[model samples]
Target: MIIDNGKLNKQQRKAVETTEGPVLVLSGAGTGKTRVITDRIVYILENNLAQPWQILTLTFTNKAAYKISKEISISDTSFKILNSKELWMGTFHSICLRILRRNFEHIGLKQNFLIFGEDDQKSVLKHVITNLGLDIKEYNPFVWVDKISFEKDKGIQDKYSNKELNFDKIYTAYNAQLARLNGLDFGDLIIKVLELFQIAPDILEKYQKQFKYIMVDEFQDTNAAQMQLLQKLTGNNFNICCVGDDDQSIYS
Candidate 1:
């Protein structure tokens, strides 16, 4: 095999060789987790198990994604997998951005809508709070931002619940301002994608079929919303490989 995983330990080799069904690798730090994932990807391409586009590799951070992509590309220069344009390798948010760009209209967003950063999000919230005649001291901008993020992560829309600072009102107005600006906050990435998939079955099926094999790095860190998105993507095929160490998991 050109994608030699000979140096991998016994457990890592097993992970690379098991190219069928759902596979989970739970190991401590410095156990060559990334190596096994990259090797498995290369093994799939080399063995003609699936096309590059059919393989979906997800990472938590852009740096890890880039590193994996780089390692795979340089693993073997002769392999055509490097030239495959269908390769889907990126962070969850980045992958969702790509999907949204193509099908944003279904979710009431333009294809070219803006993604607001922390500063812009706070600015928008401040505007909404100010117009509502609420003091920022009582309803701190950071607190409100975190509250909205928490709710969005749970796939819940801000209902006008009666609260001391009227958080519901602020959230509603904040969303209105975002809509007017044609923008979405950071937390909206996963939430919007989940919403899109739930509302549009055809779109979900399209991706589910396109990606035959799904691989997730740092699986333990996945939040509830991310897990929901993964479930939607892996409907029936269930060719998923999750690699992580629960012992080292800082987030659940």
Candidate 2:
């Protein structure tokens, strides 16, 4: 648990040491933000604040997740005392997928439900559009995919009532098609987890109690759905840390 304080600047040292409550560290590019996150994790482990499985670290991309996981694994040789692989660390979608895989049946989805990629989702949308007697040229599946994703991210439940394009009809039909195939698009990963939590408070409570500490990288890029998911998981225990820079936010 011995850390050489000389290696870390005063601010980084403080971030690494302060592990009791919600902490926010805002830093610009190349300021060693990742190092701070990994070191903080190391600090928690070294101090036995929480077990590896009780810690959840999330990033936006698979690459970033892998990078952080690897950094934590190599941060200190003492990390060998616990299996870092047991840590709940991954991209938002990947983490959600894990949760959904376990409790999807609660949301009326089978355990083996398929997860459709963008191309597969578009194909399904195209089929729905054609079956609804809409012109493919007029209702571009690509555009609709983005529109649907945007709506889902915002947690919009009401069907589109606008008559100009029958967006409501298309939206419903598209979802129906996905259900008929027992599949879900990328957007459904986060949305369905949120839905599962809402319908099953007991299940949500289990996770809230399980994950004692949570950390999010690239917090500025999180959408509404992602924010809600974080809120629910951290509702019971507010021990969380977020590191991001407003200037580097691409989603905003």
Candidate 3:
């Protein structure tokens, strides 16, 4: 199958054609960053580098994932075998949820475990704060929820510190409550998957071998947990392409 390069400029063409090793495409707004990503996938497919399922495409938001999926689906009519649904593509939390669901047993969780939303997490935190004999007015559940989430995003667990309140006790109790209810918050999703990979080397090997190529969109916005997850998956095969503008980074 002959791939078309008429729409791409020199840099975009290079980003699409470089399928071997790690490739990083830094671009600003309206510079065809998304186009480069979609076209790169097409180039890999048309060249017979990997099957549709072997390419792991990840984005930071569900909207971005949907856009990428839609672009790949309608990008070329000749590539009938290229079904975007078959590709492992989704947001970081969504992808982690998929991994955790399949390997729930390895992480001491049921297959039907619940994912707690913000309100549910706040409720759990409130209960923990009250049970610990702390005043909810002073130790606000809402504030604690954000605090815990920030720490988890940094890959820290049970070791958080603060001068004002006994956050360590609260963090421990909050996690214990979550485990009792067989639930995981959004932050737990990424860390739990990381935990699963650490305990189950065979499972990690299975995915590492399965995903021949990995592509990350908005790579500048990835947090520590997300970065670790990417590192673990790409440890064996480093065929990854990350496209993002450092100036557009939201994380400072």
Candidate 4:
């Protein structure tokens, strides 16, 4: 239920207002991307198509989410009512943090665990290779530790496909380090959630029910981890929409 702003052509109109199933919006610049997103939320609220509780929007950047919020508020204040502190619009990492924070206590966290970005994760890896008796001189931890992040981006753990090993001890030690410190590195966010989902279907089901309309912005840029996450969010009900220029994807 998106407003047919003069900005969207007929095809764009279908992409914007599409109310059911998986949707892929492939378009280039000047194709009214933000305009369509803004109008879509506007249409949903204005037409009463979705209960204020059911429309969940996911954006790639916090800045983008804020902008969408600002634009939608212009149509009516009721738009403010849909803001899901844990469910509505936000970056993948940001939203995952919310979910993790909710369940952190179950995992023995005494407080909200820290969410590390890429730079911080590198430091963790560097420390692990050094502290766990690996020869950094020979290992060149810096050269390959970044792979952890990339692998996590694709939802990969130790890859049998790649056939790299000998770090079982080091890997466990690093995880122990994060656990002792009550922190999570950037890669942990998605990978941890995937683990939690596997172990806790009930928890996953809770989120699935909570986010009624699953919309992903910049979807083509998403990697394997994010692609799996998208599936988890949408469930089998198919109330999902993905908008991105597939040609622009780097992880592909």
Candidate 5:
């Protein structure tokens, strides 16, 4: 298949066109990872290998997704997946929010659920701790939230699912409060999605079979929630593509 050579470097070209299982484009900075990504996607579509709906692509940042869109828009000499009017790109969070919202009712959530940022999360945690007879000051609700969130990121459920968690009462209370408020933080989004997948197998099966190809950016920075999501979504033989630079993982 032909690609606009002026748009992509050698590494990007190879990684993009490689239709293998869990392809990882590993390199340091300035390696045209984005170029390869767009070209690869275009080639896949142009070659009639996959459709727009069958492909699931994610970038680390919305800016990155925007850049990919701009580059692909410029290289119009190649194939196009969506119409020129369409934009099927964004960060992991954006993609998951769409998926979660659409399948919310299956998991006991509202379609218009609000996503709580850090401040909202802390506020809710504060109240949950108070209700559970815990001192928010001594335990530090903010610090507790961050630490507890780390475990959730690692695919570890709180007392709600895993009984051995020391802060089970607090975590359970925190989740209860979030549900009452019709809100979820970034960590809750991942954790709830995981929870939904576990509780609602039918919903998971529908999505798992829908996207034939899954592309993930920044593989090295993948948290437990992301890894587990990928694991649950992709079959042993499904096409999975990941691009990342390992040394760039700074702690949250």
Candidate 6:
């Protein structure tokens, strides 16, 4: 038996009951967005529209993911939803990390690979510059590093024609160093996962089949790369629901 918390209004209830392809719920703050999401999970399970393991829920932050998990546990008294191993819920990067760990062999990544932060990333760039025998002042570590990051985010390799410094050489060396260390920076988390999906169709198909339903919170905040990932995930099932408010979206 499913229980309705009676906290959602008519419109929110409509969203919860919806069972279709590519749903978008746009609403302002204090409108029980999170409540509706949890209720929607219950609705899908109660109606047998999807199994717990077949549903994938992604939040932008760990806090949002935790809140959803807590709410589901509270709302579902039997704890069947909470105890299900098939259920997948986490931040986007964390989810990608889990996938990478399981299928790292296919993507040529170590299962125990480390993720480097900004400081570590800068350190790697510095090493690359030093190894190339270039002076740090002329090369400008911070400026070049920022450019490289921008290029990575855009999913393209950028070139610069500064007579004294070679951006391409620096970029190539930086990537090689990262590969040697078996590490990935924050941006590569999503980029490499997307690359895996493109290069390995069978693996991508497995996940597409595993997750029959996908829910994304803070959709408006999603950048181009994130949107591409969502597109690929939902291509087969088209059972995606994004909940966010345009007005509240701080990220472009």
For lDDT, the strongest prediction is: 3
lDDT for model 5 comes to 0.73
**Backbone clash total, candidate 4:** 0
- For every model shown, what is its TM-score relative to the native structure? 0.92, 0.93, 0.95, 0.86, 0.87, 0.88
169-219 per-residue lDDT for model 5 (tens digits): 777677788888888878877777778888988887887877778887777
lDDT of predicted model 3: 0.87
Residue pairs with colliding backbones in model 6 are: 53-86
Clashing pairs in 2: none
Tens-digit lDDT track for model 2 on 191-212? 8999999999999999998899
Q: List the residue pairs that clash in candidate 1.
A: none
Question: Model 2: how far is 136 from its true place, Å?
Answer: 1.1
Write down the lDDT that model 2 would get: 0.84
lDDT, candidates in the order shown: 0.84, 0.84, 0.87, 0.70, 0.73, 0.78
- Model 3 TM-score? 0.95
lDDT of 3 by residue, 103-147 (tens): 999989976999999999999999999999999999999999999
- Cα RMSD of predicted structure 5: 3.0
Residue-wise C-alpha lDDT for candidate 1, range 1-252, written one tens digit per residue? 335666778888888889889999988887888777888888888889999989999898999988888887777645657853468988888988888888999989976899998888888988889999989898878778878877776663445334545866887899889989999987788888888988999999999999989999998888777888898899998889999989877664
Model 6 misses residue 181 by how many Å? 0.3
- Identify the runs in model 5 with alpha carbons over 4 angstroms from their true place: 1-3, 6-9, 78-81, 84-88, 156-166
Could you tell which candidate, 1 or 5, scores higher by TM-score?
1
RMSD of each: 2.3, 2.1, 1.9, 2.9, 3.0, 3.1
lDDT of 6 by residue, 51-141 (tens): 8888899888989888877777766454466663457888888888888888777767776898988788888988899899999887777
Q: Which wins on lDDT, candidate 3 or candidate 6? A: 3
Q: What is the lDDT of residue 50 in candidate 5?
A: 74
Off by over 4 Å in 6: 1-5, 77-79, 138-145, 155-166
For candidate 6, the 10 contiguous residues with the lowest summed lDDT are 156-165
